[model samples]
Target chain A: MSEKNKYQNRRDFVKKVGKWAVALPIAYLGYELIQKTSAQEFVWQIDPYKCTQCGQCETNCVQTVSAVKCMHAYEMCGYCDLCSGYLRQGVKERNTGAELQLCPTSAINRSFIENPYFAYTIDEELCNGCGKCVKGCAAFGNSSLYLQIKHELCVNCNLCSIAQTCPAEAIQRVPNSKAYNLKDGYKPKES
Target chain B: MNKKILYILLFIFIGWNYFIYGQARFPKPEFDSGYNYPEYQITEPISPVWEYIDVAVLLIVLTLTTRFTLKTRSRKSIILISAFSLLYFGFFREGCICSIGSIQNIALTLFNDGYTLPLSVLLFFLIPILFTIGYGRQFCAGACPLGAIQELTGIYPVKLPKTVETILSTVPYIYLVLSILFAATDSHFIICKYDPYVGIFRLNGPSTIMIFGILLLVSGVFINRPYCRFLCPYGVILNWVSRFSGKHLTITPDICTNCRLCETSCPYEAIIPSDLLQEKESMVKSRKKFIIYLILLPIITVGGIFFLQMFSENLAMVNQKVRLAKELRLEKENEIKAISIDAVTFKESGSTLEQLFLEEQQILERFRKGTPWAGGFLGLSLGLALLLTTINRKRDEYKPDQGKCYSCGRCFEYCPIHLEKLELK
Candidate 1:
């Protein structure tokens, strides 16, 4: 190759390297910007305080099956043997029979803590928001049977179909702060 | 045929890879009831195939550039590989945070909430600006997925009429400025929202936006990736950054054998054949025109935007498409009412059903208005201006604009001049 051509080649090489160097920061920053902003998680939760356990949440949703499921507040249970929520009317003792239990699926566990005192714990998998137990519990015992949303299956459509159809107008939209509060007698303070 | 099939298979593999990765790495944003639910949205993960395609394109380009620099015997293979890589990558991955989108996005984000800019977003703005100042439009040549796609697909290269090219190139700049102005004034990045190709890569976003993207893809066959060329906000950034990229894709005097082979290679009509170049005293006049255009471009863009904003209320009222279905429905109701019918027959028609039908039509109309063209004349005029004014040449000048360049390095990789340089190094 001619000397001039060699000199030109050298100049071009340096220029190419310089271009790569210049591109480094841009490529780095571009990669970072794309990675960071693209899909950051947005926190989501449903407020238990506003849910009426009205059962509409389970039926009226757009999804094949409603994503909303009831949750048990096990800690709040008094462990009473003659549980007012579980025992049928005119019954004095807790029994494992279907007629005695308010839950259609017999999902609620009735335990004898002492004579005439009973404790009840709810099984969530079988609890559709029928509200049968909640109504029974609220009327007789402490209103411990309440609704909480299970987010695992919820599609979270923009305008909730279930919330719109709720009869008692109980499913109120709440912010992320108090997502899943238990409906066990704890009243929220006004901001 | 085999090569095309191979290329397609490669493309599918890459796309599938991205799809799988996107599915695994980034799930759809779950329902959030917080302030961040819809606001601080998580961008869905893009196709995993895009990652592979991007790498493949860059590598292929590098290999080709190396071959061109070295004056190697196997240069054609390298170039072919590079072309294939870019095409597969560009087509399957699509483009996002693209220089065009980025420029518009950053400018608007900055102009909007004075204090709310994130550090990452700021970095996006700064890097592209610096690149444009130094390089040229490397982003358009390399990093931009849409550009890469177009470059690959432009197999039967044909130059558009100069008048058309001149008109189209100016549009992006005007769009950039307007996007910035609107963004500053609290408007969303309309450019990004309407970006057609982004939905292809991300798989899902707004449905109308995706339809626009499909239009871009179909149009890409005839007009090249028009978005990257004329309408991408990120292109503005790449153009700026490219100025600062010291080593640009330039058509130097030495590389000129007066042979117009390179002209045939450029689908963008960026390259002027030697006969055309030497024959024209038009160069000086063109330069002068460019200067005048630079000054007037801003004025027209800003003024046009102002005019549009001023009449926005009226424009909204005039978009008859928004109310056509509803008006039609009401008219039908009145017509039905005018017809004196028996109560039993009237009940059979079902007013409730009609109302539901009306509601469904309203929803469909809402979707239509959200289409990219819904911005109507404002978007079209701006896109036209940028495309018409922008001038770029390869061989005689391989100057890729920085703001427009995604730093995909396709120019550096594909430039015959640079490829020769790579061999000696």
Candidate 2:
């Protein structure tokens, strides 16, 4: 065999090996990613049932305003004229007054629905996840107001500060698939 | 055979659309509220299973695209595949978990050991680069939804001057460095946050992004793949990889005739004229300049580091923790009239101001470390670009510029030699 032909064959072999060199690492990385995902690891989540409405979610989060937001269960809410979630405990009137508001941010918007019912909506942008409303509602009325981590806002931190300080052990790792546990059918325990 | 393939692709496209649009009926809620419910709720967190499906689809599409680009080299087939990808990856997927945005995920995973990126994000990041190394940006030709959207809207592309294009091209490199730096430090996903087309894909987002998307589409009418050309960080990586591609789509199927017929055919200005070779004296001068530039590279890098160090406070503010710290400080100084929600929330947490300041100091230190790295990388890229411009290489015929050419096959039709080859086949 000629020397040139041998060199040509070697070049071809090197080219073939180069292709595999690139392909193998990528294939291995893809496999690793798949394995990691399929492992069904735990994701950060909040248990509404166990939550004590301590307002730690507002302060303990790594994010500035906290990923935990007060979600109102409209189905569970009675839409009463005198909503415990919206008004302070010692308020004289049920009317929408700035001073009578429970939420420090005044995030709760109350509207007249009927003669006796007033619809309440939580403005998510303004609500600081302080759980002041949730505490008020759980104590005096239906436990419709609860805190859940908005997954969109959450970075899914490895060590959740809120979870660490939670008195009721309310915050726990859940499967990524069922990260959020809604309060749609939640029945508050009798105090 | 090509016609059959096109028909099959079209059929799959229609079938896929039908499958996506066909939703199963669910029972109405037992309790009805008087208030009108939103037609669609907030985006549900994507399940791991769905992520797996997206990865599988991306892999299949990438493989098919590579095969079609290398084997058939048919413009029509490429267009059909691109259109299908546009519908499936762009509209159907709603542009989430995109390769362009996945750069952030990969960066975060690399820098932060605690964060585990999903399988789909890894695939989305790697597959395109792998494909580019093997087949020279076949991913960009059609498979990229971002590119596909721009390509579709590119009706009458007017070529910009080479100088302007060169200057504009530097933006992506700087953007790439900044995005990676930010992501690595847990600052923000600026790439995903600013993705103009994400709004268009989901059919709703911030009005600012919506307006930006509209403006980009409008510009696309006269500029070919504006985002891909000037702003895509992922494109920077692909371009780097494609420089060493084993096989690439040639403008002419056989040999170039040097007829200059297809010189202006590429709207992207990816076609290189054979007259770029310079005289020996000019080459000598350029070589000298290249050496001088090489020596200045490190100086440039150091300068960049110092420049970025000056803005460390500003850069650190991208992190919410850092921003909160600053806000709290201002509130303490009585600079702020009302206590911000962030400041109030921190005070309510019972955490001490000293602790907050300590945390803020640590975050600032991280930024101090990260910004220099970003600046250094930016400097290196600038130097490399300068070196590339200074170096002169000989070329015999009009050919597609390897880095800039997306292998869209637009020039294939214009090449008589390519046409003849097709006819013979």
Candidate 3:
């Protein structure tokens, strides 16, 4: 071939090599990211039955405020005049009073439905996940109130602090599909 | 017009009076006896399977769009696909798990080893950029719901001045850097937090964000994808990749006839005019300016680092830890009359103030290290923009600006040569 053709061929080869040099790394990085993503096997969650209400969720979480929050099972509630979840153990009267409240933040809002029937609702914003109410309810009432990690608020930490310190071993890594274990018929594994 | 105004005023007066009277008629509830609880509705989260389906649909749409844009160059197909994307990606999906917001997820994952990124998020972030490298930004033409929403509303877009457009385009780079910085430092996802159109897609959000969404749509009527052009951080990546794509959309399949009929076709003013005359003196002057800018680039970058360091405290405020630290400090000093809820919570948790201070210091250290990188990136971008402006290129015919062009195929309808070729075929 002539001098011009040889130079042109060399330039074309360089251009092709340069294109691949940029393309290959990007393709490889994308593949690596995908691989890393696929290998993510666990999601942080709470086992309702195993939880002993140790109150570690209040302090041991990596998040400044723990992702664990109180969820009310409205169906399971008895709507009694006096609720174990809302009241302190020994009170003079079964009326709503500042001193008689079990929750430090007064998160449980009690409303009068009728003469003897009153509804107890957990005000989520004020709940600190200390499990004082859950502990009180399970000890005396229908075991309606339980602790579960709110997935929306959770960052899905790799090593959960609450899990590490859980005396009951209630916190466990589950599949992402079953991240939230509700109070309805869900059982925790016996350790 | 005067009568219409009087009628509107009269209607408003009657409505106001009616509302006042209606309020007075209803007796207030006894707060002591009965407390009304707002009905809390629990929304079921969208299933993981559906998210995977959305990803699949996205990939399929992107491939089809690339084919339609580069191979067929069919405007009709593009419009049809864009409408489909709007229905599925915009209305049905409610615009979450989008590529624009996924930048934060990727940044957070890279910085925080504790955080594991979901598969769908990684796919959402990478797919469009990978596609852009091979086939230009066919994704921008029709696949992206955000782009499609604004594109459909671009009815009578007014061409902005080149200088103003260039300056506005720099905003996305700064936004991208800030978004990554905030996400990496575990502050907040600024991109997702400030997304104007996601609120519109979901049909409810903070009133301020909803109003901002409405304003963006109103502006879209004459601004031609204002968010995509001037605010989208993901678009910056697409633009860079599309610049070097092997195959890209062109106005005509055949050679140009030097016809100026397609001159005013593009609403975005992306068409570059032919440079027929040689101005040697101006070129020499620009070359000197380019050299000067090259010399000043490092100095500007170093200055940016120091400037950002000065505002480290303000930047660190974005992190909750830093803000809580300050609050605790003030409370201890008696400077704050009321103890904040977060500070109260910290004190009650049985953790020592020294531990809190140590955590705050660590977070501040992260910000100190991260902000300088963001500043350096911004400075580099500025210098590069200046360098690009000073560098002159020779063009013999009207051509599309490779980085700015969306491959919309509007100019094809105005090209006589393209029309003639279609007729002959």
Could you arrange the candidates by lDDT from highest to lowest? 2, 3, 1
lDDT of 1 by residue, B144-176 (tens): 456655655544444678788767877776676
Q: For model 2, how does the per-residue alpha-carbon lDDT over B1-425 read when each residue is reduced to its tens digit?
A: 99999999999997785343221122123333465532212334445576677777877777777776777878777777788888887777677768888888777767776667665567678878887887888889878988888887888979999899888988999889888878888777788778888778766655777899999999998988999999999999888767667888888777676788898899988887776343443777988999999998888888888887888789888776777878878777976843654565466557888998998998888888888888888888787777777766555568787788898888888889878888898
DockQ of all models, two decimals each:
0.03, 0.10, 0.07
Ten residues in sequence with the least summed lDDT for candidate 3 chain B: B21-30
Query: Against the true structure, what is model 3's DockQ?
Result: 0.07
**Stretches > 4 Å off in candidate 2:** A1-82, A86-143, A147-174, A182-191, B1-47, B276-281, B334-338
Error of 2 at B64 (Å): 2.3
Give the TM-score of chain A, superposed on the true chain A, for all candidates in the order listed.
0.61, 0.75, 0.74
Give the TM-score ranking, best first. Answer: 3, 2, 1
Q: Candidates 1 and 2: which is better by DockQ?
A: 2
Q: Estimate each model's TM-score.
A: 0.45, 0.73, 0.74
Alpha-carbon local distance difference test for all models: 0.49, 0.76, 0.75
Q: By TM-score, how accurate is candidate 3?
A: 0.74
Task: Put down candidate 3 lDDT per residue, B310-398, tens digits, no spaces.
Answer: 77779889876677888888877977843654565566556788997999998899889988888888888788778877867655567
**Cα RMSD over interface residues, candidate 2:** 12.3
Better of 1 and 3 by lDDT: 3
Error of 2 at B105 (Å): 1.2
